[model samples]
Target: MMIRDVKDMVKMYKLLIRFSIRSRMQYRFNFWTGSFIAAFIAFMEFALLAVILSRFGTIQGWSIAESAYLYSVLTLSKSIYRTFASDVHHLEQYLVSGNLDGLLLRPLPVLLVLMTQNVSIRFGELLLGFGMLAYSLGILAGKGQIELWSAIPLTLLISLNGALLLFGIALATAATGFWLTRISMLQNLTEDATHTAIRYPLTIFPGWLKGVLTIGLPVAFVNYMPALYIVRGEAGPWILALSAAASAAVVGAGALLWRTGMSRYQSTGS
Candidate 1:
């Protein structure tokens, strides 16, 4: 019975995702424009990096190529996370206006429905991310710094693991809305700023900030720790196992927080 129920949920999730895509396409201009703007923003961000790197040639021993690789990996992982859990990142809206009340009434889980909300694919981000990742890897491979065969697949593994790590962090942050009812500032610090920091090597950050990101949020496990082994070969393959472990632990803790918070939820009625 449990297996059957799980299968049903998967089927329903697919149907909801299709409904979401059609709903989004109903306004093709808006959807495409959003994609264009996202791509443009990514381009501009990279351009800023280029200008900085052109002057200094490197940041704390990280070349432009290596930095781009970090950005691309994180971007791809973020794309995956946002693709699935866009609404999970916006739980404050539900908590504020009581939209979550409607979700709770659904036969399916509230979290599952939330995952299906605003389910548009991030095409622009994906394109730029893939382009940068390929370009960076190509440069490294040319220099014989890394092997394309093993590196590509392993990087992909890390991307998937990174997505889970990101989702776990986002989930936990959003779960805090159950208590605080306002988590935008926290999200900006935890999700936005911390992610931006990892685009560069962690070595550049001050000790306190690094400690917060590494211990408090643990985003370091998503990209930096694994990248040490993948791109630079500075760590052993054990780093991958460590990252996988961190992802699972955080995800489990986030799920627990979400459940505990739900128990204390108070609905503001319509």
Candidate 2:
């Protein structure tokens, strides 16, 4: 029965992907242009970071290469979340416009329907992220700071977990839409602040702020902890183990919050 259910999910996912692709293809030029602009903006952000590193030489004892690695992990996490779970990111639209009722009426699980409703054309950001990660890893490998064989697998694991962490945050933020009706300000503030904060090493922040990020938001577990393990190899075992645990905990909490919010949902009368 479990296998059958898995197969059914795969079939449904494929159908959803096909529908999303066809819909987006209707404006192929727009899709491609949007992708290009996103990639360009990401590149420019990194470029600006590189310029700063050139002047400052290091950030809280982390070199430019190390910081790049951190940036890449965060970028990949955000891109992955944006690509796969974009519906959650845009949940305010559904709630405010009454379109969420249509999703609730579907036979499929509401979360699954929301997730596969759209597959964003954000491949460009993913590609740029990969490039940055590879470049940083190469530099570190040459300096004997990391072993590519082990680090590659660890990076992949952390990246996946980090993506889940971001998705969980997005879920919690979107869940507020049930009560707030519109949550763009809250969502943007949370996402933008967290993203900006994680771009640099967490060591630079004050003790209280660091504690808040580590315990409250827990974005630190997504990149900073893993990056420390990767570059210095000092916290390998504990960081990796804790990252997996934190990811699971955050995602579970987010799911619970979402369910609670759904219980309170009062659809906008369409």
Candidate 3:
């Protein structure tokens, strides 16, 4: 059964890849233009931060470089996640039109099928963002703010956690599609919330709001706390362990919610 499941997933992935390539081929000009537009958006976001820093030398005692450090990791993780799980972000359409039934009929996990269903050519935007992130990391290293060797692993972990957090939010949002049949508004709200948190230091917020963003929402675990630990050399083994544990909890909860929603699903079109 395991072998069959693996083979089925591989087949699905191959089909998804072929469809994605063909879609890109059919819309080559649009694909490139979309990539440029994506890149422009990322650049503008970073540029806005620069302008803000110019006006205020520090945010919550975090200098421009420190904020940039966090932003780089956040953006890099977002790019990677968006590139691979674009379908999760836009899952509402599937529920709204009962398209999910197609996935249910497949001999594979519905979530995996959904994940490999679409590939965003717009990841060109993230690739460009990564370049900026690398540059910022280099600047920090030059100032002796971080050691290159140790920073590498920390950065990777931070990025992975960020992706996990985004995936959790997306899965939760997607699960809502079962009830709402359309969830674009919720998706926008979650994405915006993530954007605001990741682009700046969370330390500036009031304690109450911080708690809301931390435990109530847990966005802090995505980037801020992890970055703090790495930058300050204050994170112990337990902190890292908690981050991993938190990610698992979120992912596990999301999966359960998604599966429950699926079980309740009734095809839209009669």
Candidate 4:
């Protein structure tokens, strides 16, 4: 029965994704234009990092290419996260207008339904991120800093795990809308600010802030912690296993929060 239900949801998710794509394609110009703008913004971010490295040489002990690799890793993760679950991050809009009441009426899982809405592909980010990753890894490989054979697969795995980490963060943040209808401020601090901060080395920040990032939010697991071992070889392969475990743990915690929040839910109408 459980397996059957899982299959049911998968079928439903695919059908819904098709509907979403069709709805957006009704405005093909907007779709293409928005995609280009998103990709351009992502490119500019890496360009800024590259410019900083050109002037300063390296971020602490990280080389320019390594820093670029770090940026690409996070970008790929974010692109993956947003591609499959764009509405999860924009949940506040639904909560504010009481649209969630409609979703609650559906037989399927509300989270899965929300994940399918606004299914943006984020091709720009993916293209640029892979381009940067390849370019940076090429440089690192040439210098014998990393072996392309192993680094390639591990980087892809880490990027996928990083996407889960971000989705969990966004899930927990959206669950807060159960009590507080307006969540933009909370999202800003948790998702926007923290994401920007992690683009650089965590050690560059103060002790308290670093602790907040590592413990309070744990976004560091999304990139920095794994990079320590993956790029610098500061530890053994155990870090990769730990990073994967951390993603699962965070997702479980987020699911717990979502259930608790649902129990306390009060619709604007009611």
Candidate 5:
């Protein structure tokens, strides 16, 4: 049954991709323009980091180049997740119109269904962001900044961590629609908080604040902690262990939140 459900979810997404392509084609200019703007904004963020690093020499002992390397990995993860989970990321409309009824009729998990319903085809943006990160990582490697080859696995692990963490946050926000039909603000809040952690080294913050960001929210640990271990040598073996445990805990908790929300769900009036 689970396997079958997964297949159905894949099929649903294929259909949605077709539909979204057609829909987007109708407004090609807007789509392309929006894609360009988004890509530019993402790029500028890294540029800003570069500028700051040039003047300040280092951010809590993390050089500008090192920060860029970390940011690139974080951005890559975020852009990839956003591209695939665009629908789940913008689920308030489904809840508000009681459109979720249609999804519930399917055998697949509701979250998977939501994920497939909308896809971001901004491959241009994704490519550009990834390119910048790749270039940065190469520079870090050439400068003897990072140890041989471990960077790739570490980057992949943290990217997975960030994806799980963000998905959990989105799920929690979507769950809130059970009680409050409107959730645009909640989504914004989550994104804002996430970007904050992604943009800076977690160690720059105070100890208590760091604890909250690392554990309470767990966003910092996604990129910052791991990067520290690799880039700065501050990460002990125990810290690496804690990072994995923390990510798993968030995933488990987010699943529970979604399950609880589903039980309380009262479909919006049609």
Candidate 6:
């Protein structure tokens, strides 16, 4: 039975992928424009940051290359989440318009269906992130701060965990739509705040803000800790362990919240 269910899931996933691809292809211009705009925005952000850092030399003792590494990790993680879980980011629409009812009636899990609803055209962001990561790694390797071969694997692991952390946050926020019916403002505020906080080294922030980011929201573990260890070559084992634990805890809490929210959902009659 377990094997059969796994096969069914694979089949459903393939079907969803096919439909999503075809739908996107039907609007090729929109897809291209959206991707270009996203990439341009990311480029401008990095350019502005680079200009400021060039004037000041460093922030909180972090060099431009180190800051680039941190930004790459955060950007890559967010791009991955947006690509795979874009529907979850817009889950309020389903809740508000009664579309969630159709998803609930499917044999597969509603979460699975929601996640696969769209394939985001964020490839430009992904490409930019990889470029930044590669450039930063080269700089770090030249400075003898990190070994490229080992750092490659470690960075990939960190990026995956960070993406999972973001997904968990998005899921928990979306789940609130069950009660609020329009949680976009909350979602935007959380995402913006997190992006702002993680774009720089955590040490620059106040002790209280760092504590909140580490304990309350826990976004610090998503990128800052791993980046700190990678660039500084300190606390390697402890950072990895803590990051893993934090990712697990955040994702588990999000899943539990989502289940609870689903139980409270009262679908609109539309």
Candidates' lDDT values, in order? 0.90, 0.87, 0.76, 0.88, 0.74, 0.88
lDDT of 6: 0.88
Candidate 6: list runs displaced more than 4 Å.
1-11
Maximum-lDDT candidate: 1
Tens digits of lDDT, candidate 4, 9-80: 889989998998888888989888888899899889878888998999988878888787878889999999
The predictions' CA RMSDs to the true structure, in order, are: 1.3, 1.3, 2.2, 1.3, 2.6, 1.5
Better of 1 and 3 by TM-score: 1
Clashing pairs in 2: none
lDDT of model 5 at position 188? 74
User: What TM-score does candidate 1 get on C-alpha atoms?
Assistant: 0.96
Clashes of each: 0, 0, 0, 0, 0, 0
Stretches of candidate 4 above 4 Å error?
none
Cα-based lDDT at residue 114, candidate 3 = 82
Error of 5 at 137 (Å): 1.9
Ten consecutive residues with minimal summed lDDT in candidate 3?
Answer: 232-241
- Candidate 5 matches the true fold with a TM-score of 0.86
> Residues 1-270, candidate 2, lDDT per residue (tens digit)?
999999998899778867887888888898899888999999999999999999999987899989999989998988988877778888988988889899999898787788877677588898998999999999999999999999888888888899999898888888888889889999877677888899989999999999978888889988899987888676757888898888888888889989999999998764
Clashing pairs in 5: none
Return the lDDT, model 6, position 92: 91
- The candidate 2 region of ten consecutive residues with least summed lDDT is 228-237
